[model samples]
Target: MSDLAITLLAGGVGGAKAAEGLAASVYADSTHIIGNIADDDEFHGLWVSPDIDTLIYSLGDQIDRQQGWGRKNESHQVLNELEKLGQETWMTLGDLDLATHIFRTELRKQGVRPSHIVHRLAKRHGITMPILLPTDDVIQTRVKTNLGALSFQEYFVRERCQPTVNAVEYEGASIAKATSESLSQIEKSDVILLAPSNPIVSIGAILAVPGIKDAIEKSNAYVIAVSPLIGGKTIKGPADKMLTSMGKTNDSKGVYECYAGLLNGFVIDDQDSMDATWLETQGVDVLVTPTLMSSTAEKAQLLSKVIEFALAHRNVRAA
Candidate 1:
């Protein structure tokens, strides 16, 4: 067991970006992505897995770069038609993207779980990497906000994330069990990554699933998390606002505290490099590097820093 090699926990955009970095760093087949399923919802009788779809589209080169979601150059014919039919058009599903929902809904109707549906979809897109859903169960993230305790999509899409979130909860997580196959991958990984995804919603939702975090705690692999916030703001999404609403500052310290006990190491952006010494005082190893990845080269370099940082930590701890 030369440290069995790679497992990454991720959500959508931010997570997918960092995962792309890791994917390029290793043999794609060696990577396992344990993605967040809390954002899954049934739209117009079709099962839509937002996080899972983002990972696929990102890797498959179909992502809408400017929007940071949906397919690039996507058309909204299906959505427009649905609107004409008096359907709620709050959530936008593009024409090219509809093919995904159509395929997934059919499989799910035929009794396929989301995890398996995702695997089939990824393979169809020629992706060699393995992706594991944290659970095959219906564990969704619900935002306990001023508006209401709404499902992630309702709070995020239908209401446009305007609600003031008081807390985030994982619905159906208490009974949710981690899949054995996914657990085995965790057992085999050399390093377990906590992607720079929204910590409370994405990674938190996955950890809330019974048995998952316990396995990570018991595993021998190095657990690394990249901070999503840099200089009190997020690259994309309302993570900063979410943190503030939750009473955590929009800073690396808050993000660090979110995973303090679980993580063996953490990555902070170069802009927050000054915080490294302060973080080290808290007993968590810190790696300051350019966490932003606007291109393939930058992504690989960021991942390289992660690998380098982990190996260095191993050597120090072993000594």
Candidate 2:
């Protein structure tokens, strides 16, 4: 088990949930989490890497359980001050959470690599398992909507995902180079899992980085994706609507199509067992289980099943 490396591509609350599960599992020491940074944006002159910070907060057991992101027992005095100064005051960066942004911004200003900052923050939070970024380059998610092209945070947070999405783009991804640590992890991993994050923005943004998808395609690891949709709808985010708006199906099959050629297996909820059965017949492994991570026990249970499924069919492609 010490030599068995597990790598996870993750972002958002769903990704954080997956990270928490893997971090608490027996493979915690061997697991590497690669988070999405496309949702990163600047507020009050400070850089905020939402996905990465969420992972750190969640793993450190400091996440606001009710809101699912931000630090627990947080205060908004900073935001209140900004509001008094006529700032937009929409992003809602809590006082405690603002410390992370300030540290990250200062590090970025001093020319530290974004990937290194992620791990440093994770370590400082008492999180041992490595939390990494896919690239050191600045790649952002841009959604073309009725309100024009808005940044990932603008669409998801500022607008509350209400505007109709015309298209989604990973800005700067066309030439953004993948970090060596990400590729190295994929190469050394025995199992690679894509968290049940948004297919279009979260996981999609990570894959959009040059060489990341290629590395996964060429890796010897057993790669799998956990669907974010259940019964053709998302539990939290707008993945279902976004998929449909992007002219893709919103069901389990639609979610699988997003990863088309890169997956050996997929995990869907029990409600989509019929879809799973059909997928299994198409030379792809499928796992059917309860994917809603409503509790810590449930999250681990889902991941444990995924690990068992991967082990039973490890390196099947090479065979």
lDDT of each: 0.85, 0.90
Task: TM-score each candidate.
Answer: 0.96, 0.97
Best by lDDT: 2
What's the lDDT for residue 258 in model 2?
91
Relative to the true structure, candidate 1 has a C-alpha RMSD (angstroms) of 1.6
Model 1, span 36-130: residue lDDT tens: 88899999988888888899888877788887789898989889988999999898999888899999989888998778888899998877778
Q: Mark the regions of model 2 whose C-alpha exceeds 4 Å error after superposition.
A: 315-319
Per-residue lDDT for 159 in model 2?
97
User: Cα lDDT of model 1 overall?
Assistant: 0.85
Candidate 1 regions with alpha-carbon error over 4 angstroms: 1-4
Can you write out model 2's per-residue Cα lDDT over 178-273, one digit (the tens) per residue? Answer: 999999999988999999999889999999999999999888889999999888988788999899889988898889889888888889999888
- CA RMSD of each candidate after superposition: 1.6, 1.2
Residue pairs with backbone atoms closer than 3 Å in model 2 (clashes): none
